[model samples]
Target: MVFAPGEKPGLEQDEVKLQKASKQIVQTAILRALQQVSQESQQRQAPPKGGPSLQLERGKLTKKHEKK
Candidate 1:
């Protein structure tokens, strides 16, 4: 149970390493969650069923905004 005065303890070093590893793991998980949420938000913001699906009356819309 005794380590030389100047020598580092393996158990303590291992615990420090594990702490760093866990922090990295948590950070990566948070990054992934944020990315997924952004993707879902973008998908929801996209036009439904892709492209314009408007069924405006023939004279309802002005020529200024036509999809042509």
Candidate 2:
């Protein structure tokens, strides 16, 4: 099909749109992966909820044993 002057062919337009959509999808996937990795790293760096409590309990037990 012949396009008028200064107009793009339908197939060219469709290809451009497809390229843009694929790029966006790839970007989104990369961002999600990075976010997941960051969350996992943070979780590893942060202590568990039970950590402080366990430490406190151990300290108490030590004091009690020392008193004997």
Candidate 3:
């Protein structure tokens, strides 16, 4: 392909549009990744769901139907 004087090759309007679209795609991916990281950090900082755990002490229970 031949270009007129003072004309830069490989930088046509279509190429500029393509470059812009590629940049936007990269930016969107980065933004999504950052959002995911932020959400994970927030979840980690949040408290655990449900009530506290239950524990049994030593000798706390006896076998049922056992003779005295």
The candidate scoring highest on lDDT is 1
Predicted structure 3, TM vs. truth: 0.56
**lDDT, model 3:** 0.72
For model 2, the local distance difference test gives: 0.71
Backbone clashes in candidate 1 total 0
Better of 1 and 2 by lDDT: 1
Residues 7-66 of candidate 3: C-alpha lDDT, one tens digit per residue: 887669878899999999999999999999998677656634654323324846433342
RMSD of each: 10.6, 10.9, 13.4
Best by TM-score: 2
Model 3 poorest ten-residue lDDT run: 47-56
Question: Which portions of model 1 show Cα errors greater than 4 Å?
Answer: 1-8, 48-68
Error of 1 at 1 (Å): 9.7
Per-residue lDDT of candidate 1, residues 27-52 (tens digit): 99999999999986776576366455
TM-score of every model versus the real structure: 0.58, 0.60, 0.56
Clashes of each: 0, 0, 0
